[model samples]
Target chain A: MSDQQQSGGAAVASSPPVGETLMEVTGVSKVFGGLVAVNDVNFIVPRKAIVSLIGPNGAGKTTFFNCLTGLYRPTTGRVNFDGTDITAKRPDIVTQAGIARTFQNIKLFRTMTATENVEVGMHPRLRSRVTGMILRTPFVRREEKAARERAREILSSVGLKRMDELAMNLPYGDQRRLEIARALASEPKLLLLDEPTAGMNPQESEELRTLMERLRTEQDISILLIEHDMKVVMNVSDHITVLDHGEKIAEGSPQEVRQNPRVIEAYLGSQA
Target chain B: MRFLASLRSGRDTVTGMIPGWVLAVVLIVFAVIFPYLVGSGSFLDASTQTLAYVIMALGLNIVVGFAGLLDLGYVAFYAIGAFVIGWFGSQQFPDVNGGKGIHILASDRATFQPKLSGGRLDIAGIHINFFIVLFIAMAITALWGVLLGAPTLRLRGDYLAIVTLAFGEIVPRVFENSTSGLFGIGSTDFSHGRQGITPIDKINLPWSHDLLYSDANLKPAYWVALGMVFFTIFVNRRLRDSRLGRAWIAVREDEVAAASMGINLVRTKLWAYAIGAAFGGFAGVFLGTYNNTVNVDQFEFGFSVFILAMVIVGGMGNIWGVIVGAVALSMMNRYGLPQLNSLSEPLGFDVTSISFGIFGFFLLIMMVLRPEGLIPSGRRRLELREAEIEGSEDTGAVGDMSQMYEVRQ
Candidate 1:
C-alpha cells in the first residue's frame, strides 16, 4: 500500500490551484467515547474551484463538513473561512458570513413553491422592516420585486425555470436542482454540496457534473463536494482529498489519487 | 374595446377571475345597510358583535393560519385589553391611601368614594371617555403581547402552544385575583375575584348624544367595531405580502431551514405572537365596552377555543377564510342556536343544545374529511393533496423511505 501510494503521490505534487483559499481547516478532530469520527484533518479549498472529499463508509466526510458548516462544534480545530474564524459560529451566523450548504437529505420547505423556496433563501439580503412589510410600503414592494427577479434568475441558472411549481411536485432530479438553486439564492461565496449525485441516474449524474463545472467557471463560486461516485468526482474535481478511517490518507490530482493503494483498499477489499 | 379584449383574455385561463372586488363591494354595502333593513335592534346588535369576532378571527389567522402556530391561550391578551378600559375608563381603581384620596379624574361629574356595596367593592373616581380607554387598551395589550412573546419565542410547536395557554390562563386569574392579596396589592377590594369588575364605561360618541338610544347606545360601539374590522383587514393584507410575513411563513414551514437562510426565528416568531396578541387585546377592550362589564369568566379557555375554531374552520393561514369563519361561527353561536330551538319547539322536540352539538359534529367531520378546513390556504391545500398522493404512492416503498432516512442519518 505504501509503495502504491508513493508511486501515485508524485503526480499530484505540481497541480495548479484553481480556487482561492475559501476554507482552511487545521488540526480538526472529533471524538465520541472511544471512536474518533474525524481525526486531525487538514484541508484547504480555493474559491471557484470544485473540490471533492471522497472516502468509504464511516470515513468522516460528512462529520467534517458538519463541523465546518457549524452544524456541530469540532472537538478540536480552527476552521477559518475567507480569513474569519468561524469554527464555533451557529449555522445561521455561518450562512450570514457568506457560506451556504445543502444537506445529504434535501431539507427544502416541501410545502412551499419552488419560487417561494428560492425567495426564502434571499431572506437575509432583503431589507424591509416589519412595519414596512405590514404596511406594504414602497420599500417592501420594491424589495419583493427585486428578490423575485433574483430567485427567477437563480432557478433558471439551475435549469429549473419552468418549475415555478411547488417544490414537492417537482421530479426527483429537478428537486435536487431546486435544492442547489435555493442554496445559490443565498449568494454564498462558497457552496458545500454534500453528495449531490447520491441517488441520480448516470445521465443525471453526468448533467450534475457538467452543472458543477459550469457553476465553478461562470458563477465564480467555490465548491467543496462530498461524493461517493468515483467517475463524477474524478471528472469534475480540480483537486481531490481521499479519507479512510476518519483520516486523510491521500490528497492530490485525480490521476494521482486514483492509483494510490490505500485509497483502493479503502474502496475495494484488502485482498484485491 | 379594451374591456372586451381583457374579458376575452380572462376567459382563456383555467383559474378564471371570480370578480372578488364586486362581491366585496356588495358585502360591504349590505353590511352597512343591514341594521336598518333588519329593523330589529337586538338582531342588529348581535350582527355588529359578530363582525367584531370576524375581525378578531382575521387577526388570529395571521398567527395560526399563516405562521402555523398553535396558540391555545390567545384570549389572555383580549382579557388584558378589556380590563385596561374597564379599570381606567370606569374610574374603578380604588384610591391608594386606604380609599381616602382621589385616584383618578372622571370624564363626567361623578363623586368619589370607596366602600363594600352589594357583594362588590365600590370605587369612585374620575372616569375616562370610552374612546380614550379603547386606544389605551390597545396599546397596553400590544405591550403585554411583547412581554409574553419575549420569553417564549425560542419554543416551538407543542411547547409554544402550552406556554401560551398557561400565559392566557394566568392573565385572567391575575386580574380576577388582583384584589385578593395574591399579587401583594393588600386586598384593596378592587377587581373583586370571580365576580369581576362591573359598571364598565359605555362607549359613546359626540354625534350620538341627542339621538334616541344614546346612553349606552349599541350603534356607536357597532361603528367603532366595524372601523376596527376594516383596519385589521387592511393591516393583515399588507403584512401578508411583506418581508416579515415571508419570514413568518418561512419559520412556520421549516424553522431550521429558515434560520439557515439567515432569518432570525426568534424575532419572526415574537413578531407574529405580539401582533396577534395585540389584535386580541384590542378586541377584548371593545368587547368590555360593548357589554359595559368585565368578568374573569368572559375571557375563559372556552373563548380561546372558540377563536381557534373560528380560525380553523375559516382556513388556517387564509385571511378571507378567517373572516368567513368568524362571521359564520358568531352567527351560529348567537342566532343559529336560538333559531334552532324555536324550530325544535314547533316540531315538539327539546333541542335547545342542538346547534352546538351540530357544530361539534361538523368540526369532527371536518377534521377527518378536510383537515385544512372548508377553505384552506392555497399552500395548505396543495400540501395536503401532495401528502395524500405521496402516502398512496409509497405504500410499498417503505424500504426506500428507510434507506433515505439512513442516508440522512
Candidate 2:
C-alpha cells in the first residue's frame, strides 16, 4: 500500500500535532549470559498515538517491552516516563507510574469473574483501606461501588457487558478485548498491548483496528503495541519500529519501514 | 423493556450477597445458643479450648493459605504468650525475704507469701485478673511473631519451614531453662524445668464474686474465646476481600504476576507473617487460661505440625475450611484418639499403638486419595483435577496444557 493510503486517509491536513512525549528510552542494553537480548535501543513514543514495534521472531521485541514495563531491568540506559526515571522501578511501581500492560499470554485472574478481573486492574485506583474494608465502613462501600461502576463501563466498552461471567469462559477474541479493557481500567496514561490481536480472526482483527483508532482519538491515551500481523500493524500504527536480532534496524512511517530493504531481508531470512 | 432488563441485572449484581449473609447469621446464632446446648459448664470448657485453636488456625491460614508461606514454627508465638503471662501473674519469690513474698503484680502487703508444694508453685500474695493476663499474653506473643517473622520472611518454601521449626523448638527450651537466676524468684537449682509453671491462678470474674475460686470452669472463658474467634473471622473476611488480601492471593497464585502489578513483595509477605503470628498470640493467651497452666510441652513441634495439617486438610486459602479443619483435627487429637484407646484397651491392643497407627493410616490415605484436603480451595481443586485428567489422558506423550493449546492452535 502507498504511504498516503496506509495512513488510513487520516493524514494531517496541517501536520499531525506533536502530542506529549510519554516514554523515552535512551540507549537501553540488556545482556543475558553472553548474548544481548536487547542492544543499545533508543526510542520515543508520543502521547495518544498507536506506535507499533514489529520484528521477526527472536528480534527482542518482547524483551524490550519487559525492560520498559519493569519486569526486567535493563543492564544499561534509562527509561523516562512522564518525567520520572522508571528504569529500575519494580513492575508494580512502573504500573503505578501510569503505564499498564497486557501479556502475550492471557494472564487474567482466570477464576475471577470478568468484572472482578477488571476491578483488580483498578486496584491502584481504589481508595479503600484494610481497616475500612474490615469495618465495611461507608467510605469503603462507596469506593467499592465506584470501582464496580468503572469496571462495568470498561467491560461494556470492550463489548463484554455481562461482567458476571468468568474470564476463562470468554471466547478467544473477547478474552483479548477483556485484557485490553483490564489494562484500561488501570487508568494508565500509556497502554502496552502485547499481540493484542493474536489468535483472532480477520473480523476480530478488523474490529480491534477500529477500536485502536477510536481509543487513540477519543481516550487521550498512548498505545505501544507489538503485533505480528503486518496488515493490522500497518493499518493502525502512525509510526513503526522494526527490530532484527535484538537490534533496531529501521523506524519510520509504516510505508517507509515496509519499503526498507533491510526490514524485508530480516523477515525473508528468518522465514528461510 | 430496559427497566425490566436493568432490574434483572441489578438482582444478578447482588449474587454473592445472599450466601455470605446467610452464613454470617448462622454463625452468630450458633455462637449464641451453643453454650446452653452443650450444658453451659462442660460445653463452655470444650468451646474455650476450640476457640484457642480456631484463632491459631486462622493465623496459620494467612501464612499457608493466603500467602502460600509454609511455617512449621507457629507454636513459638503460643509459648511466648503463655510464658509472659506466667511470669507476671504468678509470684516466684516466697522465701526471698525469709517467708515474705515478692509478688509481680503488687508488693504492697507484708503478710503475702509465695506457696510451693508438690513441685508446683503458687503465688498467694497477688493475683492479676485473667482477662488482663490474656491481653498481656497476646501482646508478648505478637512481639515474638514479629521477631521470628522478620528474619524468616526472606526464606522460601522448605528453607523457611526448617528455620521456623528450629525456632519453635528453641523458644520453649529457653523459657523452661532461663527463669531462675536473673528473676531472683527461683534459684538456679530450682528451675521450672520440664514440669512447667503450675498452679496457675484460675481466671476470675467480677460477676462471680463468691464463686471466684470454686472450680476452674470454662463458661466465662468460653464466652471470651467465642468473641475473639468471631472477631478473627470478621477481620479475616475483610482482609480477604480488600486490596491487601487480593494482593496476598495474587502472590499465592502467581508471585511474578503479583509483583508485576506493583505489590511490594517484602511488605506483602511480612504482613501475612505478622497477621498470622498475631492470631497465634491470641490463641496462646486463651490456651494458657484454658488449662490454667503454661507448659513448654504444649507448644512443641508436634503442635505446630498439627496446626499446619489442620490448614491443609481443611482447605488452604478458604476461611471456613480452616475452621472446619481446626475443629475436626482438634476433636481427633483431644477426643477421638483417647476414645479409640479406651475401646481398644479391652480388645487387647496397646492404646498408643492403636491410636498412632490409625492416625498415620488416615493421613496416608488422605494424601493418596484427596491431596487437596476435604474442602479444597476452589482454585486448588480445579488445578488438581485438571492436572490429573490431563496426566491420565496422555500416558504416552507427556505434554502440558500450554503445549496442548499450541498443538490445537
Candidate 3:
C-alpha cells in the first residue's frame, strides 16, 4: 500500500496540464419516447481533472452519463473523447478508445472474482484470441500473467484487499471499489464513475474521494463522476456541473455552483 | 431436506478432501483402463457412445453453460457432424467420378467401390481420412453454428431459446428431406431421405495399412473415443481460463456491463455458438462412425434436450460437472432404462418409453433441490446460493424502514 502511495505521489509532477479538454460534449440530449431525459447539455472534462455531474432525483445526470458512455445514443450532439468523434459508437468501442465507465447500479460480473472482473475490463487491451488462448502460447501466458498482476495492482490501488472474492460476495463498499478497480483495468484516458459512493458511509466516501484524486494526480487520467453526495462532490471535484429536470442549471467550481441561485432553487426549490 | 443437506455436505467433504488434480488424474486413469475392465463388448460400445455424449455436452456447455446462451438446436450441429463423416467417410455419393470414386488417404478396406477388369480396387465416393473428416466436421459445424447463431444475436433468454429450438427442429428435417435434392436445388441425394447414410468407413488412419478397428473388436474404438474425450476436456479447461472464457462468463453475468468492458457481444456470443457447435460436430463424427450410420431419426428434438440436460445436470459452465451429467444421464439411458424395463410388468408401463418424462421430472427436482447442479463450478455455486441468501438489500432500498422512520419517543 505504501509502495503504491509513493508511486502515486511521484507521478503528480508528470500529470497532464490542467484546463486542457479531455472529453468534449456538445449539445447532448437524450429523449426516452416523449420524456426528454437530458436536454441540450454541453459538458467538458479537462485533462487530469476530476469533474462531477451532480443533481437531485430525476435530474438526468445518469441519462447524460449514459449518452457520454455510448450506452444511450444521444438524440442530438457529439461526444469527442481525446479528439476522437465517438458519438453513437458502441460501448465497447468507446472503452477501446480510452473511456471506461461504472454503472450506477453496480453492474460488476457478479459471479466473477474481483481479479477476473478487472481482467475483463482489460478486454480491449488484450490481444489473446481463441487460438492463442486454447493453445496457451508463451506470449498469451505472459500476457495473462501480466494482466493478473496488473489487475491485482489496480485492485489494491482502489483499496480492495480481497482479490479472489466474488464481486457479489464483496461488501457493498468493496463492490463499489471493485467497480472502480475494474474501470481502471482498461487503462482509460478518462474514467467515468456513476455514484461511486452511493451506499457508503462518510469514511468510505472520503476514501473514494482520495482514490479519485490519486487516480487523477498519479495516473494522469481525467475523471467524470455522477455523484449524489455533495460533500464528496465539493471536496474532490475540480469542477462541478449541476443539472435539474434534464437541463444544465449551473456549471462552475463547487463554491460557485453551491452559491448559484438557480442551482440552489433547483435543489431546495424556488422558496429557498 | 435435512437428509439431503447432510448428504450434500458429506459429498463435498469427500470431494474436497482430495486435491482436484488428484481426482482428475484418477478419473482419467480410470477412463483410460475402462475398456479393459469391462468384459462385455456391448458395455464397451455403450461407454464409447457415452464418451461421444460427453463431447456433445461439453460443446453445448460452451454455449449454454459458459456464455449463458440457451441453444435448443445443438442437435443441428450433431446432424451436420454426422453427415460430414457420412459424406466423407462413406459411399454416400456412389456417382462421384462416374462411379470410379475419389479416395484421399483412405485405406484399401474403406475403398471397396468396384473391381476393375485388371482386378484393381476402383475406389468410389469421397473417402477422406478420419482425422481430416473430424476437422472438416468441426469447421463445417462451427460455420453452421455461426450462421445459425447470426440471426439470434439480438435475442435474449426465451426468445433466443425459441429461435435455437426452431433451428434444432429445422436442420434434421432439411437433412431428412434432402435425399432427392437440397431444397430442390439439384438432383443430388443429400441424406438418402429417412433411410439415412450407412456403411460409413471404419476408423482408419492415413498411415495405417489396414483398418484400425472393426465391429469384431471394440477396444480400439473405445480408446479412440477416450482420446477424443481427453482432447475435449483439455480444450474446455484451457478455454475456461483464457481471455475468451472470461468474456463469455462476463456476458453471461451481464451483457451491458460486458459490452461496457469492451467485450464484443456479437463475436463473443458467436464464438460460443461456433466453438460449442464445433464440439457437437466433433462428437457427431465419432457417433456416426461408431453407430455405423448418420440417420436423421437420431437428430430429434429430444436429443438436443438430452445434451442440454447433461450440461444442466452436470452444472452448466462446470466442465467436470457437465461430463458427469452426460455420463450419468447417457448410461442411465443406455443401461438403467433397459434394466428398469424388467420392472415394467409390475409398473404396468414401459420405463424406456417415458425416458424424457423421467428426465424432465429429474430436472424439475434438481432445479428445486440443487439448481446449481451436481458438480457446479465454484463461481456458479456461489452465484445461486448468494441470490438465495441475499434478497434485495443491494437494490439501494433501505433494509430497515422502521429505523429510518423511528418515533420521537
Candidate 4:
C-alpha cells in the first residue's frame, strides 16, 4: 500500500457533526468502601467536541474520567461509547474499542524512544504476531514501517521535535505533547486528557489548546479533558460539566457553567 | 573527570568505529573458526558448554531484563528441556507398542535395538531426531512456562521471584522422585531416579549416516552450539524490536500506562516467559546431549543464580552483553578456577570452593559501581542516570506540589 493510503484512509479529514453523543456515562458511581469517588455522574461527550470536566481538588474529575476509560469499574453505571456499552471493560479492551487516554502525570514509556512510545500506542491496531515478527515476513515489515512513519507523522502533528530522544529526556512540555501523540496513535474515537497542560508555560498551554481544537475539527476526534487550568477549560470546551465532592453540580456551555452560582461556590467555598 | 569521560565514551569508541553489522559479522566468523583455533578437546567442550550457557542467559534476559519480571527459577525450564531429550532420545522407555520402539525420523544408529523374535533387529524406545527433539523441548518448556507464569500474573517484584523460585525447586525434585511415573499412576518411568539417564543417543542428522562429532572430536558439538547461539541471538534481536517487544517494554515501564495503551499485560508478559523458557529449553537439550547425561543434580538453585549472574553482570536487556557475561562466567568456572588451582595448591586452598563467594563479591561491586551491569542498554543507562540528567536539564519545570503538601502538613 502507498504511504498516503496507510496514514490518510483511517483518519479522514471530515469533521464529525456536533450533538451526536460519542460517549454517554449515566448513573456512574464509584464507591471505595464508604468513600464515594464518583457519585451517580451523568456525563456526555458530543461528537468532535472538546468537552471539559472541571472541579476543585477531591471533586472526582479524574475518577469520572477513569470510569469512562475503563480503568475503574463503576459501582453503578453504564458507559455507552459510540453506540457500544464499554462499561467495566479492561483498559486494553477499551483502547481497542476506540477510546484512548493520557495520564494525569505524564506516563510516557520513559526508557523508550519518543517514536517507540508512539509505536507502542499503535499496539492494538497492528496485527503482526510473534512468528511473523521473528521471520520478518514482508507483511510484518510493511506493517512495522508504516507504524513508524505514522508515529513520526503523529509526533510532528502534535508539534513535538526530537523524535529520537528518550521520552523522559524530552522537555517537560514536549513530554505532555508526546503523551497526546501516543494517545492519537491508538486511533481513538474519544481522547481523554488528564491535566494535559499541568506544568506547561502559558505559551505551551496556548499551543495545546489550539492543538486540541485542531484534533476535534480536523481529525474528527472527541476529547474529554480533565483540567485544573480554568483558562484552558473555559477556552476550549464546547460544553462543561462542573463537579463538587463527587456529584455533578453544574452542566452547560462554558459561559453558563462559569456563571452558575454552585460552580463558583464549589471553586471558592460555601460562603462564596 | 578523566575516568568519567572514558567511562562515557569507552563503548562508543569501538562501536562507532565499526558499523554494528560489520562487528557482528566479524564475531560470527571468529566464533565459527574458534574450535579449530583452540584444537584441544577439553577447551572445545568447555566452549560448547559456554555457548549453551549463552543461550540460557539470553533466554533469561527476555523475562528478567526486557519484561522486567524477576524469574528466580529459570532452571525449571532447563530441567524440563534436558528431561525431554532423556525421554525422547534415550532408552528410558523399554515397552512401547509391544516392545517395537517408537522411532520417528531417527538416525539408523539410534533405531538399532538388540535382536528379538528369531534374530530380527528391532527398535525398542522412542528415538526422535535431535533437531526435532530440540523443538519439542522448546514447545513443552514454553507450555510449562505459561502454566507456571499464570499463577504469578497478579504478583510483582519479590512475590513473583519467590513463586518462580518454588517452581524451579519443585520441578527438579519431582523429576528425581518420579521413578514410578507422576503420582505413581502409571508404570512409565519419568526419570531413572537419582542415577539419572546416561549414554543418551548421540547427535546425528537424519540424512547423514555417520554419527555427528561426540566426545572424541567435540568440534561438531561446538559448531552446533554456536549455530544455536546465533539463532537465539537473531530471535532475541527481532523480538526486542517487534511490536510484542515494545509492548513488553511498555508493560515494564508502567503497567497502567501500558494497559491504557491497549497492551494486554497478561499475554505480553506470558509471551516473555514462554519465549524465555523456550530458549532455556533449547540450550538444555544441547547441553544434555553434549554432556551425555540428564541428571537431577544438574538442575540446582545455584545453577539458576549462576545464569542470572551472567545476565546481571554482562548487562541485563543487552543481548551481546548477556552473551559476554555467560562466556566470561562459564570460562571463569571452567578454565580460570582450574588454572588458579595450581597457585592455591601450595597454599593449601582451593579457589573453586569459594567461587560463589567470589561471585557474590563481584555482583555486590557491580551493583554499587555499575548497577546497570558491565554494559547497560542505552535505555537502562538513561533510567539509571535520569535523576542526574533531569536535575541538570528542565529547571524551568514548575508544579512543585510536594512543597505545597509539606506546607499544608
Candidate 5:
C-alpha cells in the first residue's frame, strides 16, 4: 500500500496538478441508441504522468477512451488536449495533436513486416509527399533513411528483435510489443494504451510496468491507460480514476481510490 | 541506384532468395529487341496496345490494390486523357484558331502536315504539338479525379463502386452528347457527339520531322510505348515504397488504426485517385494518337471492366504482376482466342466470337485455382489465405465468413 502512495505522490488529479494538464475532459458521455455506454465522466491527465482508468466489464472504460480519442464523438461533452479544443476532431487530428492509441484487439497490419508497421506510424512525420516519392529526391531519401532508423530503434527498444518479421507471425507478446513500438514511432507526447497488460503473463506485465515507467521518466511521455489488472493499476499509475457505467466514481491517489466505498460498491454490484 | 533498387524491392522483401537483378537485365534486353524479332505490323500493333493497357493497370493498381478502393469506372480518366489529345493535338475544334492552326513544337524543316481538311466543321482546326497536350491531359484527368473522388470520400465497398461506375458512365456519355457544349451550359462544341473525333496526330518528338505512327513501320511507336511503360513501372515501383503508399496500405488494412496513426484518409484516398488518374491520362494520349482516333464508342464500361480484370488476374498490389496481367490478357484478347479457330472446327461454334466467355472461363479458373492472382503480392496473398482460413473455420459453425465480410448496411 505504501508503494501505491509513493508512486501516486508524484502527481494527483484531485489536488491541483503538479504538472501542466495535458488533457481535460468535461462531462464526456456516449450513448449507443438505447444504451448509455459512458456518462458524464470528467478527468485530467497531467504532463509526464501515468493515469489509469479502471472499471469492470461494460463499465464504459473503453467508450470513455474512444470519446477522448475521437473514435466516437461524445454524445455531449468537451475535450481540450494540449491547449487545443480537440472535441470531435477526427482520430488523425487527435494523433497529429500529439495523442496516439493502440487497439485492445491488437490491429497490426498483418501482412506488413514489423518495421513497415512502424514506418506507417511515422507517416505524419514524413516530409516527402507523392511527388518526392516519384522523383526520389535527395531529401525524400534522407527522410526515408531517418524514418527507417527511428523505426528500427523503436522496435529494439520494445524488445522486438526482428524488424523484418511479419506482424502476425510474431509471438503473441511480441505482437503486443510491436503495437506499442508502432505507437511510439508516432513520437506521441500522449499515449493511450487500451490495455498494455491485457493477455500478458505476470512476467510480461512486469516488463510492461518497467517499460511504462521508463517511457514516463526517460521519454517524458504521458500515458493514459484502461487497465483491468490491479497490480498494473496500483503500481504504475500516478493518478487513478475509476469509471462505472461511464461515470467517474473516484479520482485520487491509488491508496485513496482503494479505500473509496463507491468504487467497491460499483464493482461488487456489477459482478453480482 | 539505391532508390531504383528500392523500387524493384517489393519481391525481395517477401522472398529475396533469387537474384532478380539478372532477371531484370534479361527482361530489359528482351524488351529492347522485341520489335525487331517480329517486325510484322500486326504483332507490333498488338504489343503496343498491350503496353497502353499496361499503363492503365499500373494506375488502377494504385487505387484498388494499394488503396483498397474498389473503383469500377477507372476508364473515365482514360477517355478524358484521350480527349485532351483529341481537343488539343487534332483539329476537332476549329473556331479557336480563327482558321489559323496552332502549331508549337512541330518540326520546322520538314514539309509534313496534319490532315486538316476532314474536320466536321468549316472552321480551320488548331494543331498544338503532342508533347504539350500530354501534360494538359494529365492535369485535366487529375482534376476530374479529384472531382469524382469528392462524393466517394464517405463511401466504401460496393457503394463506392456504384458511384464510381456511375461517374465513369456519365463522362463518356457527356462526351458523346455534348456536341454543342454540356447540356447547353457552354457555347463551344467539346466533342463531335456520336460521330467522334478523328485524325489524331501521331506521336511526335520535338526533334522528329516525320509522322512516326504510320503503319509502314511501327518500330518508333513500339519504342515510344515501351518507354512510357518503363516510366509507368518506374513510378509505380517508387510509389509502392513511399510514405504515401504505406498510408494507402494502412488505410486499406484498417482505417481507424491508420487515422489514429495520423494518416488523413481523405487526403490519402484523393492522392491515389489523382496520381492514378494522371497515369491513365498519360497512356490515353498515346492510345488516342496510336489509334488515330478518339471516338466516344471506344470509351465503354466494358473497357473499364477489362482493365479491372487485368489487375485482378495479374495480382492486385504487385506492380510486376499487374504489368504481366495487362500484357497477358491484352495478347489473349488479340491473339489467343483467334488462334483457337481449331476449337471452332470441332465444336461447330465460332471460337473468336466466344472470346469473352473464354476470358470468363480463365477468370473463373484463376479464382478457383489461385484466387490470389498470377503474381500475388505478399500482402494480397496473406489476405487471401486469412480469408480462406476464416472461411473453413466459419464453415465448421453456423455463421459464414461472407456475413462478416459483407459491407454494413
Candidate 6:
C-alpha cells in the first residue's frame, strides 16, 4: 500500500522507516463471479516485522491472505516475495519458496501426532527420496535422525513436550500453538497466522502474542497476523493495516491506526 | 486346552523363557524345513500360489490403503508382469534366436524343455532365464504404473477407481485380442492367442534342475516365494516410515493441505502406484513361472477384484492386515471351495463351479461385519469408531457384538 498519510482514497498514517520489503503486493484484485472479494488492494510487509491485519468480518482479509499465499491467484495484479514475482504460483511452490501459513481453522493433521504434523512442515527442508528410504542409506538415516531431533526441539520449544499426543487430542490452546509449531518447522522467511488466537482464552492470546514476538526476533521470521483482539494486535504489531469492504481503509503504526477515523468508522458500522 | 495355551504363550512355556529373536529364529528354522515336514507336493504347490497372491495383495495395499486411492485395475500391472515373463522366458518368438532356444542366466537350463525329456527341446526363439525375466517384469510393470498413475492424478475416489478399472479391463483385452502384434503392428504373436505361451521355462537355477520337473520337489519355489514375502514386508515397512510414506498419508488425509506442505500430489501418488506395481510384477513373474503359463484368461477383471477384496478385508493401511487378508482369501479360494464341494455334493450342486459366488458372499460379510477390515490402522480404526458413534443406528448391533468379547462369566 502507499506510504502516504492519505492516498488511494483511504485514510493512512505513517510508520517508522521500514526495511527492504519482503512482500510487496501491488494493485492485487481477486474477483469471484461478480463480487470483487479483494478489490485492488496494495499491501506491503517489510522484513522482520510483526504486522497485524484487522478488519470486520467479510472484509476479504482471508481472501487477501489466500491471494498472497497462492491459494487463489490474484485476478488482477502482482505479488513479489524476496524479489520473486510470485503472483499465481501454486500453494506448494509458495511453501517451498519459504512462505509458510497456518489456517484460521487450525488445519493440523487431526489423526497424526503433533510431532508428525511438525515433521510434515520439515518436508521442504529434508530430502530423502524413495530409493534412499528403501535402502536405509547412511545419509537418509542421518537426515531422519536430525529431522526427529529437530522435531523434538521444535515441539519442546513450542511448549508441546508431549510430542506423542495426537493433534486432535491436544487441548485447544495447545492445538493452536501446535499449529504454529508445525508452521515454524518449515523455517519460513515469513509466517502468516490467520486468527490463530481465535476462540482462545485471554491468557492463551497473550501467550501467542509473546510467542509471535519471540518468533520474529529469534528465527528472523516475519509475522502477518489477522486478529480481532485489539489488545494483542496493538501491543504486538509494528504495523497495522485496516480493511473495509475489500479495500484498504487505514495503514500505520499502532498509535497512528488507533487515531485513524476511517478504521473506527468501519468497525463501528460493522458492530452497529 | 492346557497344551494349546502352553503353545500359544511361548514366552510362558520353556520356549517362552527364550528371547523374542530366539523364538523368531526357531520359527525361521521351522519354515525352512516346512516342505519336508509336509511331504505333499500338491499342498506345497498350493502354499506357493498363496504366497504369490499375498505379494500382489500387499502391492495393491500401497495404492489403495496407504495412499487412499481406490485402484480397481491393479491386475493390469500383474498382466503386464506376466506378459513380461511370457515374452522373455518362453519360446513365444522363434524369430529372435533364428528358431533356436537360448538359455539366459541359467547355464544348466534345458533349452526349450517343456517336459523332463532328458534332452534340450527345440522350440521358439528367446528362452531367457526366469531370474532375468523377473526384474524385467518389475521394471515394465513399474513403467505401466506411472502411465496408469498419470491419468488418474486429477481423479479422486470413485472416478479414480473407474479409470483404474477401465485400464484393468483394457490390458487383458489387448493381450487377448492381439493374436498378432500390438494392434497388428508386427507378425510376432505375443500371447499365442487363447492357447497361450505354454510350458513357460521352469524356474531353473544354474546349479539345479528346474523345480517344476525336479520330481515334485516344490521346496525351491516355496523358499523363493517365502523369501519374496519377506522382501516385500521389509520394503513395505521401510516405506511406511519414510518421507514418501508420510506424504502418502498426508495426501490421503488432505490433498490440499499436503500440497500446501510442498508434497507434490502427482509425485506422491505415482510413487504409490510405482511401488505397488513393481511388487505386482514381482508376483506376476513368480506366478507365471510356477503355473507354467501366463494366459490372457488368468488376467481378468475378477482377479483385480479378488486382490482388492483382500486389501479391504485385511485392514487397509495395516501391513499385517493385508497379509492376513491376502493369505486368508487366497487359501480360502484354493482350499475352502473344495471343502464346500463335499457339503454341496449331497445337495446335487457343484460348489466348485460356484466357488466365485462363495467368495462374493465372504466379501459381503466382511464389508458389513467389519468395514475397517481385519487389522485396521490406528487412524482408520478411530475414524470408523467415530463414524459408528455418530451414526448410532448400529449401537444396538455393536452392543450385541461386544457381548461376544465378555468372558464366560
The parts of candidate 5 lying over 4 Å away from their true place are A1-18, A270-272, B1-18, B107-123, B345-354, B392-409
> Candidate 5: deviation at residue A268, Å?
2.2
Query: How many clashing pairs per prediction, in order?
Result: 10, 1, 2, 1, 0, 4
A-chain TM-score in candidate 1? 0.91
Give the number of the best model, judged by TM-score: 3
List ranges where model 3 is wrong by over 4 Å.
A1-18, B1-4, B15-17, B113-121, B346-348, B390-409
What does candidate 5's lDDT look like per residue over A28-125, in tens digits? 87887888888776789999999988988888987787788777788898999989999988888888898988878787988899999999999888
Candidate 4's residue-wise lDDT over B79-120, tens digit each?
999999988888888897677777766766654444344644
Residue B116 alpha-carbon offset, candidate 1, angstroms: 26
Query: Scored by CA lDDT, what does every candidate get?
Result: 0.75, 0.74, 0.86, 0.86, 0.83, 0.81
Model 6, B23-92: lDDT tens digits are 7688679767888888757788888888899899999999988899999898898888888888878778
Collision pairs in model 6: A1-A42, B10-B16, B11-B16, B94-B125
Give fnat of each prediction, in order. Answer: 0.63, 0.35, 0.75, 0.75, 0.73, 0.49
Chain B alone, candidate 3, TM-score of: 0.91
Query: Which numbered prediction scores highest in DockQ against the true structure?
Result: 5
The ten-residue window of minimal lDDT in model 5 chain B covers: B400-409
Interface RMSD of 5: 4.3
Ten residues in a row with the worst lDDT in model 4 chain A? Answer: A8-17
Question: What is the C-alpha lDDT profile of model 1 across A208-235, one tens digit per residue?
Answer: 8888888888889899999999899999
Which residue pairs of candidate 4 clash?
B101-B123
Tell me how candidate 1 scores on lDDT: 0.75
Residue range B1-409, candidate 2, lDDT tens digits: 4764575467556645667778678878988777767865654666668778988898899888888888988888888777655655454334543443333333222112233344232434234555666666666666666778778865666899899899989887777776565335535423277776655555545333222322344455567788889888988988988777877876765555555555667777877877788778777766765576788778777788778878877878888888988888877776777787787778887665444455557667767767676667776666566567768654433343222121100
**Residue B408 deviation, candidate 2, in Å?**
34
Backbone clash pairs for candidate 5 read none
- Worst 10 contiguous positions by lDDT, candidate 6 chain A: A1-10
Q: Tens digit of lDDT per residue, candidate 3, span A1-272?
A: 34533542353222222488988889898887899888887788899999988889999987787787777788999999898999988888888999998988788888888999999999999998789988999999999999999999999999899999978779999999999989888899999999989999999999998888888899899989899898999999888887777877677787777777767777888793
